[model samples]
Target chain A: MSATADAAGPGAVRFALEGRITAGTAAPIWKSATDTLVSHPNRPIVVDASKLEYVDDVGIALLFDLTRRERPPEAKVEIRDLAPNLATLIGAYDPKKFVPPAPERAHVGIIEQIGRATERQIEYAQQMLGFLGNCFKAMGLALTRRGVLRWGEVLDVATEAGANAVPIVLLIGFLMGVIIAFEIGLVAQQFGAVIFVVNGVGVAMLRELGPLMTAIVFAGRTGAAFAAQIGTQKVNEEVNAIHTFGLDPVHFLVLPRLVAATLVLPVLAVFADVIGLFGGALVMVGFDIGFVQFYYQLLGAVSMTDFLLGLAKAATFGFALAAIGCQRGLATGAGATSVGLSATSAVVTGIVVIVVIDGIFTVLTS
Target chain B: MTEPSSGTTQMSAVSVRGLRMGYGSRVLLDDASFDVARGEIMVILGGSGCGKSSLMKHMIGLYQPMAGDILIDGESIVQARGEAKAALQRKMGVMYQSGALFGSLNVLENVRFPLDQFTDLSLEQKNLTARMLLEQVEMAYAEGLMPGELSGGMLKRAGIARAMALGADILMLDEPSAGLDPITAANLDRTILSLRENLGFTFVVVTHELQSIFNIADRAIMLDPVSRSIIARGKPSELRDHATDARVRQFFNRQPDAALEQAA
Candidate 1:
């Protein structure tokens, strides 16, 4: 192939091409044309291809590059006297070299930012409520039909989420009791009323800390687990597969977790309360208070109302945690990162809901 | 192998010799051998769980064979280490069954990933290169879309673009036609054929789809689950017509092989 360039005018150049412009010969011609265009910037270039024999896709791409180059204003390109077949081929190729860049987003004001966040929150709350309603319906369906609930799966989930959680709950509850008693006893010693440490520990453990701590642990452990497990199932299309088989995932997967958490958490919380009292007893012994005296003071300080209220809080927190977890899981997006994000969101939302509900319970009781 | 006039010998782009592959003690394939010539499409054909994908994974160094070696362009990838291994790895690209595109990245960014990791190209050049590759696969329109936003067919096209990003001499694809409709699958086969003709890259495709096999395969090896070894090796039409093995004949004709069922 031969390419001959001639000056059309002061601001224009024309090239005459001949012979085949296949992949082999297109590169050098392309390089020379690009070099010539660079040297003569801001000039109209025309290719008179009447003598040209043939041009392939790569050859068309080279010609298209002339029009697509980043040049100063006043630079233009025109192809003339081209064969109709080559023109048709070039049209079909339609090399896109001048796609516009995406527009930069402007910053939003604080009010708009807050408004958008609130909108998202409302949407999330609506979805969660819908999920909860479906769970209740599924629960009712399971109750009406025998063997629909999968008692084996329910027992498995209960064992995994509840029985398996005993050690961590006991450890955290014991540490929390020790920390509280030590801090409060130090202050009470200053007032010469160290015996009041037993009352404070008993009341706190029975009324607030036991349920709150147990709920937070459940949120971190069982709630995150539920999200990751269901999210993975969602990613792998296993959730959809279940639906195709006429099984409700809420009934099969979530109801077991919710029921298990509700049944198991209060028992775990009571265990935590007893363990926390022992922790308080240990602190009281360190402060020279007898175990008998501490036990009597604890009995005098805690009442049936406080114990029942704490158990109620525990059960409610359990339900909220499991619900949020299952909701986050069912709402999982595609891919692995979404699974991780679901687990994280489950834990975060579960804790937030737990704390908010705990505050409401406290207000109602007060 | 005879040396060709193109400055390189007519050696296989990939060679698996006496390959025994499996997990732990369960042998999936035993004493399997194959050669994939340069610039030709080689298809690994089998029914479900017949270890076609396992063999592809072993050849790609994702899984080590229990015995034997894999050679890429005369270099032993099975025994290669460190920089040598990385060099061999850079010579080949893999497209997984699910596309396996990074979910966080847009189509353009996912295509640019291998180029970014291996090349010193400028940002603009990288973006241009990615766009060009996407255009080749007809995915340029969806460059800004996330992997999750793409349909199954579109995702596979994007994956092929990404696999071609590094300009690898060899490309391995697992189930390129899986989950796609018949027309889309045929179009994908056309894309593979055109790409091979234009770019001259060797392809090692693992697929059970009969139409895809007949359309794109220059040569194919069918694995038999019963024997746990290659049962047929030839062109698709040849295997479909003249294969003496009843199992291989059943496979190409899409019939339920009695032997396979009995083995199961």
Candidate 2:
């Protein structure tokens, strides 16, 4: 079997004897021959007939049995590189010839072959399109199917992506507002226009910075959580089980988190804006801008449109997180290594998509 | 579709005809045909890569057949949809080899899943039904524990509990005893028998476990590993008596003494 396994790599075994052959030579040769054919059935094998080996009728019968009327063991086997004259006695040297088999439809022509390849390419394109189509269908199902609200999962994502993230968003928002207000207040005072500091901080936070900064924070936080959660499920074959149960995994799993994040993010961005504006108000008031007047100017500069725009951007960022997280997780196969790879890909892809989408919205809204 | 005539001779739970399945040039099942009767536990036994799971998948309508018809209660599963598929699912319960309980859900939730999804049962009703099932499978204490917290035997029992949640008339258990200890395996078989006795549901169990086969199967079908064909199907005693095939005999020799006693 080992010898056969080694030699069988290229073909099925075959031999021919022209003179008196005994079992002594035949047995070992038969072993090697059957062993070779047994090991690698798919690869083509050829027995050289020009060596003029003679054999008895029994050895000849064994040879015939080995090559001519042999049952190919369970795998596809074909004999190739046969000499024409010996091929007659060897009975065409085609293993499939003896095995009654279904005939395949023949290729039409050269042009038709190319057309077939082109058709295959078209088929692949259709497959990819169908996969994407299914994704959209899943999105639609997500909207319609009311998932059993997993409060635990919600709190888990919240604790990990939201609560743990508050310190950073707050710190950044407060510092940025204070720095801008202080710098702008000094510059404004030189020109006796210190009132403008409130306008500067309010405009920046509400129009652009608040949403962008918070999304970037969450791009690190909840984005990673989504990847880890879904990736682990994929690794454990939990996703496959969902499909076996006739449930759309995306609708049951991804949609709730997506809805939660999308809803929560804009609210977080608004909170960031409020804190940032207040921080700026504190610095501006120290620079002789009256508290009431600073509040008035801040309100005037930051309109409902500004908050709405930031909310819109935050929503876009949310979509990016969900898409990247779900895509990477679904792409994962069953292993811890695959899950790790998926997590990294999720983060990278989420950040890229978020930035790209943010820029697109900024340009369009501008 | 053959309608079940008032409890005399049970109609076939699953009937497959001219079943031809292939992936690329590799044909797995070629013109395979078989019928499994109601209340008769049937096992599709085969070695690794012989398409036992694939055939089961087709039977369950997970993978569409390449070329053939699968009749579950006389309606082609391939042609089944909407209410038809839903009807089929409601009629049949499946337990995968891995005991695929949803990890996020605890044992109770896992068992309650089919009821919550398919039944109009209220939350309290679902919970009560789920608890009843867990108790039936002897996993009532494990109800609050997640799938990860359960042992292999416990997981299999939990899976079985979930399978029975909908009170499916036909249960399809794939490798239900694959990874369990001998005691656990025997317990699982006992549970299966109890389900049959109590609920009178038909079962189609796919497994290589001879112990399970003799313990639970009313009729066994041998899927030849080499030929990739159904070489024999009959009562285990008849298979032992009439089965001249070397592989079939080899399978019988390996059956546990408990299975043989159960068969007797």
Candidate 3:
């Protein structure tokens, strides 16, 4: 429990340390050493531990502090004849206080930044293609194998993504149709062509607006929901757990959402089209156009080709939205921030993909 | 640090040297070092935000240390990459604080996870192994139940079973009985002790529960927030009784040790 200091010679001091070196024992020893060092400022301190019995983390910490103290440039501290276990303990508990500086970054030109961006976009494209390919393979497997697909989960997702979304989709569609009819009727009245207002609303709602509006609604609602659900799973390591089980998350998670969205989007689009036409019919009756004339004109203007094309586009858009949302979720990084980022990116990517596919479809059809 | 002597000498399951841990520039622990001997249950105890779980995470390779290296079976996990890293990872299984079981998977399937990933065991063999591990944890009756359907104690048991799926030599558990009742926590401690005695796998458990510490720990290390390093290390009872540091004393005794505040 005691540390005895001896003045061996000028400019040198030796301390023989014995018994336990613990929190209780080290404090007195530390004071004695500090007193000795203050008396002989320029001397080299030698601590002999050959007779020491025990040491703990606190004891090791005290020794480390002693070794790291500021002293004269020529002064040194040394510990000798330490027991193997004590030495190991000291080595293990000693802290590395100095931190290395971070590596310097090289300057980058604009071209390099552009090149990096392009490379990132290309990589992202490749990943999306790979994911789509996996989805197709999973869908194929589901078709070939009777029980491989989680039909119950698919139905659940369908009810959630489609049936639950009906009210909002119909509301937005009806409002859009009413607005288009009113705006066109205001101009048509000046030229005595108010009857033609029904034609304008009918073409827009049936061929383009119906599917596009439904897809956008689903993207914001269901796609974001998919991202949030899967992102949370990723953060919780449940996704990793799935991987650990030798199961494909894309097959188990993404496939169900994809199947549900694709199956129900066309139905939603058809519903939106009917509701939007009814809105136009409401406006048409105000302008002295009968329900029969409005119905006849809507039928004449919107053929089966336009209606089927819109449904087809709705299905494609549904697939795109689901793919983007699930992909964002599956690719989520760790943390709470990443979950929000996944949801945000899912909506953005889903909308962008929907718009691009819609443009391509319009060009091909026109 | 030099490698421990091999063959005749007892080997440590995990060794940490000069560990500096923190986020970015904010250092939480400096000069952290310790070792868990093979087949020993080492409890990491600390006050809240003292980096107990952080230290465990570093040891299990969840996050890289700010400085210093961790070695498992004398191999430096920090320096290992690719196959070496994967091999090292395979030797250890981590049970997260939340159990982290796949919600979609039943208890049996959760336990079979590691086997499915790393082994060529047939479906029947995997199921049998999963059931056996579940039975060891007394969770066999809940084999068909989902994680969301389990109680706190049941989740912990199921998590332990899943962690044992691959027969990993080391298990790292982050607060195994954190939210359990006293009776359940004691039962978990007994389960851990018996598992250690039977399976001979080393465990590194991060927890602040005093009873569990005294019950299950072969050796324990207490992390001090003020020091930002280990302040005490020994058998839990030995530390509780003989620790000379007031902070250590305060911790084990569940005291405030605030004489100055009382006087004021």
Candidate 4:
């Protein structure tokens, strides 16, 4: 394909377009044609389309750019021998349109970058607080009403996010328990107080490690899955479909996932605590601390208040993680990359929220 | 054209019988029945939220109908299971409204995916075939581009190539003209016409564009958002000329509800 520009008259130029005017062949022809048109400002250009066999949108855009007139809306480009059907396309487009936007600055200072980042974080935190308010309001409304919440979807989500996650959670907890007891037992051996290792393991498993570890695992696994699922639905217009049917997405989609996470996390943490203690006790045997002595020591080291506090932290962590995941998902923009971004943001945000909330709980309890 | 008392079982390529679709208590389509004769180009028309795309989704087996059956090649898709369901899927190919191409795959690979999954064709053969299909849609130039890089019209064209990769007898397209210019949209219509004439492909297209309707549809059915049923069905010309229902005539004439109210 060749595009040739020749002077038709003193103030007019004739451009002959040949062969395919598609993305594959439009580049050099585009550059030279634009260069020609831009140099000869305000002069009318004649585009000869008689030789053109095929043209796609890229070709259309090229023609528009070539013939594009500046501001006051003067039509400068005329086509000779364009097929009647192709004429309809040109008719739909304004010759004055398609001006290239001014290029943005490529660089910003380090201080400005830091300032912008800080501003964005502040905005994000503000939005998250608003979302929390909305969630609480919706929950209150649902409890007061009959048909607001979908218990079925909650059950389904709970099974997937909780029941299916048991094996992995238990495995991680067991490994953590064994590692902690082994390390502490070694230290206690030097002090000739190996039985005291049971107290350390017991308190850590119940009051700190169990809920914290389970929340972290949930952030990585269930939180990411929740974000991806909802983000894809948003991308596909499924969430919009729910909206068009006069349903609030927060009430319909988010609530079920939130309820599921909150309900299951405490139960999961309890399992983690029990299995972790079991693993720690087995490790205590290696230090010549018998199961009976270990059990009595664990009973004394951790009280019901400690156990309840851990479960409360687990529940709050679950709520925060699910809310963060759903918020990130609902905030997803267009394209496949946005869905991946939302999932990544969800896991990162969920873990951070879990840790921050855990710190608050620890301070309040202490 | 002589209408048949004896249509569907032996005569039509697709027969959707008494198909009911709804989400929860909100019914979108009810008792919707239609037949598409072999090699026919049928257009489903509706206003926004009238479930035109949803109807097409049901036909593609993306959603199960609330009631009734859709038969493709005289086989019931609603009741099919396992290999039977898989076989039914092989006969029908779909292009979604979003042109849902796999983000990770380039144009050529996306088109070749069906061939790879369903056929024992060699890699070279699959590549050549995919290239040929892309050429048919005027997208062979973009074989190396990822789905994300292509423009909306290009993405639609690539999706069409991928849908045709299976050489399925029935091709369903949702809003094929949505992102295209008049010239490109006209070209697409011509492509559909050419494909139908040459290969005897049956096309079930969901589009609201009247120009496209006139250009390509052999038969047209209008779904009414208020009525939740097919309000009009005939040649697009016939419906445009002589439809008696106010909503059908209003849609045909592109009349606003306010204008109708003023006239009354």
* Candidate number of the best TM-score: 1
Candidate number that wins on TM-score, 2 or 4: 4
Order the numbered candidates by DockQ, best leading: 1, 4, 3, 2
* Model 4: pairs clashing at backbone N, Cα or C within 3 Å: none
**DockQ for the candidates, in order:** 0.24, 0.02, 0.02, 0.06
Chain B of candidate 3 achieves a TM-score of: 0.93
Candidate 2 per-residue lDDT, tens place, A1-366, comes to 011222433344433322323322344455565666566555555554333333322233234445543544544333344333333434523335224322345769999889989997696457545544655676676567655455566666666666677788888777777887898888889998777777778878887778888887787777777877888987677888999999877666776666667777787787788788878888877887777998788778778888898899888787668656766677765545567776787787678777788789879978
Model 2: residues with Cα > 4 Å off, grouped in runs: A1-366, B1-9, B240-242, B254-264
User: Which RMSD values do the candidates have, in order?
Assistant: 6.1, 23.5, 20.5, 12.1
Model with the higher TM-score, candidate 1 or 2? 1
Which residue pairs does candidate 1 place in steric collision? none
What is the descending TM-score order? 1, 4, 3, 2
Task: Please tell me the TM-score of chain A for candidate 4.
Answer: 0.74
lDDT of 1 by residue, A1-366 (tens): 888788987878887767766444555676677777887787888877777765543455566666677766777677787765445534554545545654456889999999999999999989988998998887788789887677888889889989999999999899889999999999999999999999999989988999999999999999999999999999889999999999888987898888888888998899899899889899889999989999888889889999999999999998899889988998999888899999999999999999999999999999
RMSD of 3: 20.5
lDDT of 4 by residue, A214-287 (tens): 99999999999989999999987899999999988999989988888999999999999999999999998888
**Local accuracy of candidate 2 as per-residue lDDT tens digits, B1-264:** 011123456568789898887577677877789898876678888666788888888898888887989888787888888888877766677888778888777888899887677655445445655665676677877877877677878888898888877656678888889989998899889878866654456788889887788888888877764675788888877776678775676577776446645655
Evaluating just chain A, the predictions reach TM-scores of: 0.76, 0.58, 0.71, 0.74
Candidate 2 chain A worst ten-residue window by lDDT: A1-10
Q: Which residues of candidate 3, in runs, are more than 4 Å off?
A: A1-211, A214-223, A226-366, B1-7, B257-264
